[model samples]
Target: MRTRFPIAICFVFGIFTLLQYFSKHPTLTAMYAEILDWMQIVFVFTLLVGVISIFKIHSAKISRQERDWPYSILTILGIVVMAVLGFGYGTEYGSPFLWIFQNIQVPMQSTMFALIAFFVASAAYRGFRFRNKEAAVLLITAIIVMLGRVPLGHQISDLIPQTAQWIIDNPSTAAKRGILIGIGLGSITTALRVILGIERSYLGGRS
Candidate 1:
């Protein structure tokens, strides 16, 4: 019952949203807006669930004296400090939440993302060589894109920049858009299946 109910709701609303997108029916359009509102509520509820789960995991780590207990303590402290600042400190004070957000979270996130630069460079060198015709085109595309994004592309000639811009604006953009549209359609279909109870992976095993 627990699994089936939510799955059914998801499928029903998903189908309704899809119909609203493609069909011109006024009733379906109105239903779509209402469903979206409901989804927003569900989203908030899910966020609350996530917060609770995060707190639980961190708390347990501290309580159990797990490996890196100090890190768990730091996580908990950060969460509490941020939550307090988010709710009261900002409104009561000037903008403590925003200050912490800008200084702490943003910098840490950027630092973590910066590690991707090394990983990506490694992957390109190891995996991006041309073994075939398709791979040859891919390698050329990668070279052009790398040059265009970096400051050195202009050193080659103005033609590299022009070619990169043309590739990005035309074939790359069209292919990306097509992939996104396909993804959206797939999501709608999956949602509809959930609502109709046709897909019950969420309900646990077949038993």
Candidate 2:
């Protein structure tokens, strides 16, 4: 009964949301807006629930003396400290929360992202095997693209940048659009499967 009720709600909401795109009636529009506001409220509560779950899981790890318990302690401390700061001071530019975020969190995030470049370069070098013509073309194209973005490319030749731009403006745009179309189609299919109750994985069971 519990599963069926949720499925029924999902189907009704899904159909209503689909109809909302073509709905211009004042009543329907107002209902849709109200439902969107409700969704925002639900989302906020869901986020809080997630935070509580994280705290519970980490606290359990600490109590059990599990592997890497020290890191879990740090994680919980960071969360508590951040929450306290955010609640104590407004999240304005001069607030403690904003100051810690800008000085500590931002730099940590930047460092992590900067490290990703080297990992990407290493992965690309390993994956760019020149066993065939297609791979060779890809390798050359990547080199050209990389060089074209840098100042050194212009010094080498003006043609390098022009060719790179042309390749990007034409081939890259086409490929990107094709991928986006595929993604949209896949999303629609998944949504339809869920609405029809054929995707029960979300309910912790087989469809």
Candidate 3:
């Protein structure tokens, strides 16, 4: 009964959502707008659930004195402090929450991304090693793209930037479109499976 209820709800809503796209009926349009509003309400509750889940997990780790448990304390404190500041003081331009977000959160994010760039460069170096024809071609394309974005490439050759732009416009764009098409097809299939209740893994437990 538990699984059946969710699957039934999913089937009805999924079918309605699918139908709504092709529908021009005023009732269907109104219902779709109401559904969107309901979705926003659901999203708020989902976020609250996520916060509670995070708190529980981190609290358990702290209680168990797990390795690096001190980090959990910081995580909890950060969540609590941010929630308090945002809710109590409001997230206006001159609010402490906004100040913290702009100064602390932004810098932290930038630093994290800066660290990630080093790892990406390392991975690119390893992956771009000339192992096969395909690898060599990839390495060359990547080198041209990187160099073309900088002043050094123009100094080296007048055609470097032009060649890079051509590669990006043609081959790169074609590959990107192909990948997007594949993803769109896959998503359609998955949505259909879910709508028909053939994909029950989302209900949790053995399907």
Candidate 4:
């Protein structure tokens, strides 16, 4: 009953959702809107559950005095402080929550990303090694793109920036569009599988 009942409910709603997309009937549209509202409500409860789960896991780690448990203390404190400030003071433009988010959170995130840039550069250096024709081309293109963005490339050659812009607008954009098309097709396929009940992984077991 646990599995079957849920799957049945899923099938009914899935069909309704799929059908509503193909028709403009008032009843179907109204039901679809109601379903969306219910989904939002469900999402709020899901978010609360995720927060409780994280708190429990971090609290257990701190209690056990595990390695790096000090970080868990900070995590818990951050969560509690943020929740208090957001719910108590509100998140208006002049609120403490907004101030902390804009000042503290934004700077911390920027610093983290700045540190990550070094790792990305290291990986790119390894990846752009002149081991093959493809790698060599990639290396050259990357050098051109990087230089073209700066004043040095324009000083060296007026054509460098134009060539870089052409590469970005043509080859890079073509590849991006192809990837997006593939992703869209894959998403549609997965949605259909789920709607048809062929994909039962969400039921906590194999289909």
Question: Best candidate, lDDT-wise?
Answer: 3
TM-score of candidate 4 to 2 decimals = 0.85
24-81: candidate 3 lDDT, tens digit per residue: 9999999999999999999999999999999999999999999999999999999999
| Number of the top-ranking candidate, with TM-score as the measure | 3
User: lDDT (CA) for every model shown?
Assistant: 0.82, 0.93, 0.94, 0.93
TM-score of each: 0.72, 0.87, 0.89, 0.85
Superposition error at 122 for model 3 (Å): 1.0
Across 1-207, the per-residue lDDT of candidate 1 in tens digits comes to 777667666666666665678986788777777877987998999999998998999889989999998998888889899889887866444589888888888999999999999999898887788788988889999789879877799888878888889999999999999999999999977766666777777677452
Q: Mark the 10 consecutive residues where model 3 has the least summed lDDT.
A: 198-207
Per-residue lDDT value at 199 in model 3 = 91
TM-score of 3: 0.89
lDDT of 4 by residue, 103-190 (tens): 9999999999899889998999899999999999999999998888899999999899988899899999999999999999999988
Lowest-lDDT window of 10 residues in candidate 4? 2-11
Candidate 3's C-alpha runs over 4 A off are 205-207
Ranking by lDDT: 3, 2, 4, 1
lDDT of 2: 0.93
Cα lDDT for residue 42, candidate 2: 98
lDDT of 2 at 4: 91
Assess candidate 3 and give its lDDT: 0.94
Each model's backbone clash number: 3, 0, 0, 0
lDDT of 2 by residue, 30-117 (tens): 9899999999999999999999999999999999999999999999999999999999888988999999999999999999999998
